[model samples]
Target: MAEDQLMTYAVGEQMNLMALLKNVTVRVAKNGKQYLDLTFEDRSGEITGKFWDASEADVERYQAGRVVRLTGKRETYQGSPQVKIVSLRLANADEPHEPGDFMIHAPMKTAEMEEELNQVIFEITNQVWNRIVRSLIAKHRDEFFSFPAAKRNHHAFEGGLAYHTLSILKLAHSVTSQYPNLNAPLLYAGAILHDLGKVTELSGPVSTQYTAQGNLIGHISLVDGEIVAACQELKLDVNSEDVVLLRHMVLAHHGLLEYGSPVRPRLLEAEVLHQLDELDASIMMMTNALDKTTPGNFGERLFAMDGRSFYRPSEGLTGKVDPEK
Candidate 1:
C-alpha cells in the first residue's frame, strides 16, 4: 500500500519485507565472499541481508548501524530470515528510532526515577561525591536529560543510564540499611554517584552512543578521575575510613575486572551495589525484549542477542503498569 514498498519476493507466503530503512554495517564474512552485512528493520521487525557485492563508492555512502532502504529478495538461512540485497543506500536519520527500528527502553517513570535518585544524592555523606556529581549534572544537564542509555542493547533511552544507575543505588540503599557494620551513608553516596562519568562517557540525543573517553578510559576510570579531582577540592579528612570505602565503590562497582570493575567488590556495600546494578540492567533488557508481541508463543526475534525470540502469550489481558512504578 505504501509507495516505499512494492510486491517483491516473500520470506513465506505471508511474510515479506517491503523496501524500508534497514541498518547497514561492515561485518565479518562468516561464509561466502562478503561486501556488507545489511540489517533491515521495519515496523514488523529487523532482519539481516547480504550485499554480496559492494563497491568502493557504496562504502563511502554507508556507515555501520546507519538506517538504509534496500531492494532485496528474501531467503532463509539457518532456520531464520536473511536477504539478498539488489540495491541499497542510507535511510533518513530524521525518522524516529523507536522499538520499530531498534529496541529503546526506559525501565521506570522518568519523574519518579529522578526524584528517587535525588533522594539518594541527598543521603550521601561524602562531600567529594556530592560536589563532583553536582558539577557534572549542572554542566551537562541537557545531555543528561536527553541522551539515551545506550546505542543498542540494554537501557538505551535518554536518561536511561541514569535511570538504571539510580535504580540500582535505590535498591542498594534499602539493602545496605540493614547491615549495622556498613556505613549506610557513605555506601549510599557511592552507589548514587558511581556512574556519573557516563554523562560524559556517552553521546547522542535519540540513541545513547559511546564517547571517545568511554572507548578509551571507560566510565569507571573517568568517574575515578573525577572523584579523585573533586576530593582534592573538598579537603575532607582523607584518612577517614569512609574515603577508602567510597573510592572502592567507584573502582569496584562492576565487581570484576573482566566485567569492567578494576577491582572486585571487597566490602559488603560494594558487593550489593554490583549485584543490584547487574540485576537491574538484565531485568530492564529482558523486559523490553518481551514487551511487544508478534504472534503465538514467539513475539519476534530480538536483534540485541541474535534472534532470541521472547515468548508472547496467546491469551491474557495485557499486564498493567505498577502504580508506584
Candidate 2:
C-alpha cells in the first residue's frame, strides 16, 4: 500500500487527507440546520472542520476516535485555519496510514522517562511507602506510559502521563532538597501516584476522551481507591500514618474541594504536592500557549487559564554565546 499523503492544506486548497477524527460534535444552527463540527489531526497538527447539512447517519458513521478520509476546502475562520468539508468517510481497512501518524507524543522517550521514575522510586528509603508506590506504578506501567494525563487539558498527548509525573517528580525533588524539613519519600510517593488513576480514567493516548469511570469517579478518588486496595493486597494496615498521609496527598493534590479534591490539603507534604502539581501544570499550559504564539504577540485566550493570554517577546537578549555576531 502506498503511504497516505501528508496533510499540508493551504488556504483554498482542496484537501483529501486521511487523518484521525478528533472531537466531534453535532449541533443545530440558528436556522435549525444540523451540522457536524469536528477536528482532524495527524502528527503535523489539528484543524477544525465543519460538515453542513449533515445527517444522523453521518454523525453515527464519523464519530470521534475514528480514522477518516476527508475531502475539504481549506479556509480561515477567526484568523485560524479550518476546513469546509465536501465529503468524508470512515477509512477503509486497507488504509495505509499507521495510527502513530495521527497522534501527538511527548518529546522525551518513554523508556528514558520510565527509567527516571524508577530512579526516583528507588531513592525512597521508607520500605513500606516505597513498596506501596512501586507496586502501584509497576501494576500500571504500560498504561502509565501510554495514557495522556488528560482528555483535552494539559499533558494530553501520547506518553503524557509519565511525562507529567516525571516532570513533577523532578520539581518535587528540587523543592525538597532546598527545604530539608520536607519529607522526600512522601513527596516522591505522592508525585508518582497522584495521577495513577488517569490510566483508567482516559480512553487512550490518541483522540483522547474520558472513560465512563473517569466521568463518574474522576482520577483523584479513583487513585485514592487504588492506594487503599494496594494496602489490602500487601497486608499492610490502611490506618497506618504513612498510608493515611499518602492517601491524603492523592486526595488533596487538587488543592480544593471545588477542583475535585475531596479534602483541602492539610499536611505540609500534601500542601507541597498540590503546589508542585499546580506549578508544573501551569508551566506546561503556559509553554504550550507560548509555542502557538507568534514571537512578540499575545497568545490565544486560554480557557483553562482563566481566559488569560501569554506573551512571547521578540526582543533579542544576550545568551552565553551570540550567534548573530
Candidate 3:
C-alpha cells in the first residue's frame, strides 16, 4: 500500500510499504544486541519502527533521507501508533518512490501568500524603513518564501516562515488600525522582519536542524545584523533614530529577555509588535494542537503552550447560519 496510508494500519496487521527514512538511530539492548530505532514518513505523518537485533551492516544501510521498502506489523505504544519491523531494505531504482510525498508544507499556497505579503509591503510608507525592509525581502525572497519558521514549533511546514510573517502582518495591521497613534511603518517592518532571521536559523523546511550560525547568534541577533548590513549597503546612517528604533523592535519582538529577546519592549510600537508576534504564534500553536485531536477528544499536551491540552468539539465553531433554512 501507499506510504500515506500507513497511518491507518490497524494493530497486528502485517503490511509492506515504501517510505522515506526520516530518522534512524542505533541503540544497544540490555543484552548488548544492536537495534535500530527508526522513524518512517510520508505526506500523512511519521511512525516509529524498531528493527530489533539488527546487524552492523544493516544499521549502516538504513539512514535518514533514504527510501526503504519494509515489512512490519502495526501496533500501539504509549497511546501512539508505531510499527514493528520484520525486515527492510533500500528501495531499488525501479521502485515507486517520491521524496516530495514525505515532506510537510504550509496549508496556504506559496504564490498566494507572496501576494498577500507584497500587499502588506506596499502599505509601508516610511521612506528609509521601507527601503531597508524591501532590500532584505528582495535579498532573501527565495528562502523567505520556503523556509519553516522553526524546526518543530509554530509554522514548521514548508513556506511557514512567510506564512507566519503574513499572519503577524495582518495582526499588526489590525492592532495599528485600532490605535491610530501607533506607527504603521514601524509595526509593519517589525512584523515582516521579526522572524526574517529564521530563514537562516532553521536548516530548511524538512528534517530541520540548526546551523552553526543559528546556534551561535540566533535569528533575532542575525536579523539585527542583516538590518545593519542593509543600511550600510543603502548608504544610510546605521545609528539614525529610525534605524535604531527599528532594530529595537526586532530585538525586543520576543517580549522578554527570558524568552530570547535581548531586550524587552520599550517603545509603544515595539510593545505592540511583541504582543502581535506572540498572539500569532500562540494561536497557531493552539490551532495545530486542535488539528491533531479527534472531534470528541482532547489534543496532546503542547509544551510550547505551557502543556495545555485542547478539547475538540464535534460541531463546527464558526457559527455559520444554514442558508437552506
In order, what lDDT does every prediction score? Answer: 0.62, 0.84, 0.83
Candidate 2 clashing pairs?
none
What TM-score goes with each of the models? Answer: 0.69, 0.88, 0.85
- Please report the candidate that would top TM-score against the real structure: 2
Candidate 1 lDDT tens digits, 47-166: 566766566677666654455556666665653456666666555566542333443335565677667767777766656656656665665665555555566556666567667667
In angstroms, the error of model 1 at 46 is 5.8
Q: Tell me the deviation in Å of residue 248 in model 2.
A: 0.7
Q: What is the Å distance of residue 292 in model 2 from its true position?
A: 2.4
Model 3 per-residue lDDT at 244: 97
Residue 194, candidate 3: alpha-carbon lDDT = 91
lDDT of 3 by residue, 185-280 (tens): 889988899999988887876567789989999999999999999999999899899899999999999988999999999999999988887888
- Global local distance difference test of model 2: 0.84
lDDT of 3 at 207: 64
lDDT value, residue 188 of candidate 2:
91
Scored by lDDT, model 3 comes in at 0.83
TM-score of structure candidate 1: 0.69
